[model samples]
Target: YAGTGAQRVPLPTYAFQHEWFWLAPGVRPADATASGLGRVDHPVLTAVARIGDRDEWLLTGRLSIDAQPWTRDHIVFGMVLVPGAALVEMALTAGREAGCPVLDELVIESPLLLDEDATVQVQVTVGAAGEDGRREVAVFTRPERVDDDEPGEATCHGRGWLAPEGEPVTAPPGQWPPAGAEPIDVDELYRRVNKHAHLTDAGFDYGPAFRAVRSAWQVGDDVCTELELPDVAGSAQGFGVHPALLDSALHGGLGMLYRPGSEGGLPFSWSGVRLERTGSTRLRVRVGLADETALRLEISGEDGTPLARVARMDVRPVEQAQLEAARRSGRRSLHQIDWVDVPAGTPTSARVAVLGELSVPGDRYADLAGLEQAVADGAAVPEVVVTAVETAAEAGDPAERARATALSALTLVQRWLDSESLGEARLMVVTRNAVAVRDEAPELAQAPVWGLVHSAQTEHPGRFTLIDYDGGGVPDWGALLDLEEPQVAVREGRLLAPRLGRAVVGEPPTVDTGGAVLVTGGTGGLGALFARHLVERHGVKRLVLVSRRGPAAAGVGELVADLEARGAEVRVAACDVADRHRLTALFESLEGPLSGVVHAA
Candidate 1:
């Protein structure tokens, strides 16, 4: 049972983005009579379990059974978090309902991943008020700090149906109370209470910012509403407003008067908030503020139907002092952030090559540009790489096919530049293909070529022409054939056949063409060999090599310069993927319309 007059804040915002965490039978206690309500011998799987404080966010978790626990009356639990992760806190509790004692409390922290919007929820079991006289059979959510330095009350704002043990209250469509009701004139009351209320450090007020579009309220401790979302809102999903919207609803619902005299400030926190479904759809939000700070918030579909959801803090006023103290000290941020880096053994990056016919391949290029910009703006790194798929399905002569493909590739590169806000960068071409140029509208064996990368009107073949630009020069090869020096490695799943030492890089002045290849991880052994092949047999107009480490391997810079002197285009770039800030800046500095990317990085 939640204590009487426990302040509660509603959490209508958590529904759209919460992750699901169904407790396994083994994790739950079989009996409340056991010590500490059936001790959880198992350490929580931090990655799978939501962890954090109501006010702070989620950080990292380590084995620390000895860590201090947050306590209030009979309820008790510990906290876990670390730096560079998220700022969140988690808690646990035990209590009773009716005459049957029961395990009661659980809490979740907030803003777990900074700038990555989250939706969360919490659940609690309650019984009849004890001789102490609180509420009978209730659930609490959205606990807030009432005093700037004290645990605030959890408020009730949404729909509520009584537990099996208690009498249920229902409000039909139009008979419920006004939405987000304004508190009774409590300024003077707040001042009077302030004079006697003991103050403690709970945490900062999350401060509200989500804009509300529509809201409704019911008398029985719940509030429901719909809101308009913000732009550029960052979510785990590539593009959306779900997470951001829910957070705003939770924090915004905490618009309660602070009791300057009270010892406890806000009342509760949440365990998990999730967005089960999202889109340009109306959201159903429910909140039940038990008091000024303690609350139970639930969001659903447009017509009071259940949907994806989250619960909030099950906090009470009596425990505010310690929570407040933890909040004031900077140590509070330790609850939700995880610090390990993604391991590199697996392929960490991939580039997709779309090989098909299209008009204005520039449009396709633009799509890639937008994606790049999103990454630069703090989105998680993309798991898949993308590039123009080389194809031979166009309806045109040899020269026309080559021109269309290059132009399409150029369009994509330019789009990337636009997304990054780089001014008018042009495509550079390089090739060392030995085949004589074919004549389409004119004798073009030595003429410069240009056009759309994928034009619908062009006739093309339907084969994947694998080209090997081994470090050794194979002057006998032609450009029309998908030529490679027969070097082997993995390509599109299967192993590429090995054709070693096909073209030597140092003696370049050989083949000539009009395009370039951007080779990331260019300092690696395979990268060097590819560079040599491009310079020798492929007649690559340019070879740009990017690496995490500078030009330290194999005198690579000197070799590229020598190749350049022989009429090939060679450039070098140094970068690291882990350095997110630096990588963003680097992307903004790149030229556009690249023929292709060898994403070895």
Candidate 2:
């Protein structure tokens, strides 16, 4: 009776869409603090300490526009930011050394920006004083990497409360530019703030030393303005005011209440400030209008007296996709490679030598002046030299013979990282199936010698090792010199290495989000953390990066303004992907086709 028309129609319920395609992580942020060191007299704090017995303190500092060049004159939508009134004068010098000197509110979450050849560090902290003496503070910042070994990722950028006092310094009440007002051309208000800082997210550029206003008026719902600072905008004495004349003392409330194509907003919150003067290079501003999203500031000194007062500042809607997701929020720094598990060892005696194409089996050495004539015929400086990397076998165009075997192992590791008696020897390099473990596909003429020796092991760290074997004998210089992992991988004979690991995924992510993604190790720091784990966790919308110091490296303009403020479509490309004719003319100047390809150079 079960014969003809296949019975079980109820079986259709198991189509299994429980999904989670996994594969995308490492965003990198982590930190704690400790290093403050001593002496701090201010002028942008240098160190203050205290945070361990709990009444909290911290402080620490550094800022760069090349050591304060008026912080490259403010900028705004064109980037250089940092001014929410320099975090309300660094929370009024960390609330006057935690005795709380009154800020009563700072809030401006994130928008530090900086990066014109970066320097940032900044800290602040404060906290623990409550019982009505107030304290809380916060500030934080980062970008100071001088080749981090561990410890970075700060961020925060302003937090509030410091009390123990309240507002007072008012002044600014009419006459000086009021009588009938109207005058405000301010060079057509800075050409409508550089034509909407080039169209939207409410733009602004202002560089003639932040065009410090100079003369402005209006006078209906108020807007005064005067400022000054420029004479090449240099010394604001030692700032308690000069954050480019208090960011042009709040751009006269964006030209007296948003106009040049409206939709403007930024300086998010200040409430009852009150400074009293610290180096005013000719001030006077004003503003007024407290509703419709706040603003009532007041600065003084073009003789009307007073110095600074806020009562309220507020302003939110910041968009550039919310300051590029708050500058790629917590800028994850990840470094993954992962393999681990090599334990089960044996051999150890060493003096290995093998450098470059003398067929790389072992005791070979045809260059480095025949190993410096067998160490001046006394030999023994070989604690391990290895090298080899000559793939593209059976080739002639296996990517131009793997770019001439990675430019002859990048000219012998730049002559073994410029000798100095081979600084306690290490070198290694060797290769063959050139790394691809876990569901493989590597040997494409030896995977560009592991992407040109991982950018020469990321600019020489512990002098290079990177093995890769899986065969043609001889790598047991006493079990590979008892192993150490600067990227290993032997396999089948046992010994893997690499390690960074941590990516578990739980569900949600089908991904494709269209093309573009080249990468190739260029925007420094592991190519902007694998292009910010492919534009914030694999929604990847086009990249390119590649490096040979493109855009003259060193945080290539803050990693292309943090992956084009996270909406992606970046490009960087300095090209030298080992140079197969400038990596095939940078992939025929790509503007299309590239669903993926990271090879991290």
Candidate 3:
């Protein structure tokens, strides 16, 4: 019995039932409380969680064209890509959550492409504190819908370490513009660069976006440039430092590297990258040589605020064929030759002119001489003149040697064609391995001869013939000489001739707005023309135009705006297609599988 008073009441004997109940696996009630950590709300990021008993945190998010419309603005080689600066911002955000406010270094290994309509989950993982009290950070992303039987593999975009905020390093004294720098003509620079690309086949064709270098100058050993974002690319302000802007800043250094007849170089690697600001639309960059092969860049904002610094950057030259190969799948196809079967014809009674060395073993000199002898014996008049020009042995530098040999052979043929003694003679140039099809270095050295001779063929018509013979054995000169084709090849006792085929026009493939068509080098003259064609003719609604410049290219804004008015959506990206990791990441980021790719770049 219990006494019933104002503070005490009579209690009935009953035990409260407390039994275990099922809760969601890996979730606890404390996870619902937002006491220790806050939530992250970003178009690219979804939530943040901390791992108990470990100094680590994970931030998860998704990227899609709808959630981050501006992401579609960054197109590289026809794929919608997330800018590298955005990755840096995400890492910085994660760093801030872990009490580390500084990014010591971050290297973007691959680009992040946004899917057209679907979402790609992203995870920013911050690991336990390091010996230096900094946390290791990594960024990974995967497709949302993967096959049930296939395990989803996340793509790692980058990895680096973040450190606690420390004393800021003193930057250069605030100066509007450095003194003693000679101004560079921006228009002329682009003109020359574009011209070089066209002539040398280097494959770099910057439209408006990649033309980030507004003004530049050379002061002593330093190359200084003023870079500004294009008006259409104002959305870049959301990034930590826009890739196009940063890439353009580096373009200023190109003025220093440009030579009259050499291939242009691109950034190969970056080290010790440090960013101090969130957005920088305008920058004044100063690049100096770190050593013989690397560069050091110091960057600042419009008001002289230090923005970023790179201790070292290595730049390397690239070839056009290499870039093209990287953009396509499967083996690189060789130039197709339309083979012609020339009917056997009676030997011409007229004199034939032959040029190039026939003295070396395996040279077709004996066969050619036999034909000349047979013609002389059969007819009263000498039917052919077998003139042999000895090929010079490779001497001095290999390139110079090849050039010298080619020029020597060309001079002989030109003199023969111009001479009255050889009037009305059908000229034929012959060589062994001179038309280099395998060795690119030798090809580069010998290409001019082929170019000149091919032009002469078009101008002179039936008077000129060029033949490449295998140096392993003698060729069948009788059969080759009887053929009417201007270009022929003799390999392993067989004769091949170049034949022209009518150009065939086929119906364009069907495409819909749900998928995308990527046009590499999309900002160029031809790319723009095709983009318009795809929109108007093929009914393509989504077009991704990729170039080194992307939207920053000159006239790109107008082009994009015009396309938009025409009911076509265009996204521009500034990326190097030759970068395998970036290219793979870009492909994975697409909304759906690409409808088609026009590899103009």
Q: For each candidate, what TM-score against the reference?
A: 0.24, 0.28, 0.42
Instruction: For candidate 3, write residues 1-601 as lDDT tens digits.
Output: 3565447666654432222233322111233235554456443554688898888999876666665554555444455556555676778778777888666666665556554645667889999997889888889887665455343457787788788864453375455456766877887656654564342355344445556787877678777778887643434533566655766666655554555565555455455566677666788888877765566788888788787777766655644434333333211112244654455436554545443355322223243335445445663222344443334566667677667866875785576566554345566666554454333232344455556667878987766667766665876566666667777666555565665555332323566656899998899899999899899988888888988888788889888998899899888888678888877877887776688898888
Query: Lowest-scoring 10 consecutive residues by lDDT in candidate 3?
Result: 326-335
Q: How much is the lDDT of residue 278 in candidate 1?
A: 34
Give the whole-model CA lDDT for all candidates, comma-separated.
Answer: 0.36, 0.71, 0.64
Off by over 4 Å in 3: 1-43, 64-89, 108-119, 146-151, 165-170, 189-210, 234-238, 254-269, 315-601
Better of 1 and 2 by TM-score: 2
Off by over 4 Å in 1: 1-105, 108-224, 236-247, 251-253, 256-282, 291-293, 308-313, 316-601
Best by lDDT: 2
lDDT of 1: 0.36
Mind giving the per-residue lDDT tens digits that candidate 1 earns over 1-601?
A: 3768777788776674544244322222344334323222222212111223221111112222121110111111122221100112112111111232211222333211111111112233333344543322222233222236444233221211111222112222441234445433323322322343332133232212223334443334444455444322222222122433544444323433234443443334443333333342445555555456554455555654444334444444534434333333322221332222111123222322222222211223344545456556765443222232342346367677656655555555445345433222222121222112222232232122222221211322221122212123332221212222112122222223332232221232333355567777777777777777776677677777878775766678677777778787777777875688976776676675456566676
- Lowest summed lDDT window (length 10), candidate 1: 68-77
Q: Which ranges in model 2 have alpha carbons more than 4 Å from their true place?
A: 1-57, 60-83, 91-122, 125-153, 156-177, 182-222, 225-251, 256-298, 301-303, 306-324, 327-512, 521-574, 577-588, 593-599
lDDT of 3 at 521: 85
- Among these predictions, the greatest TM-score belongs to 3
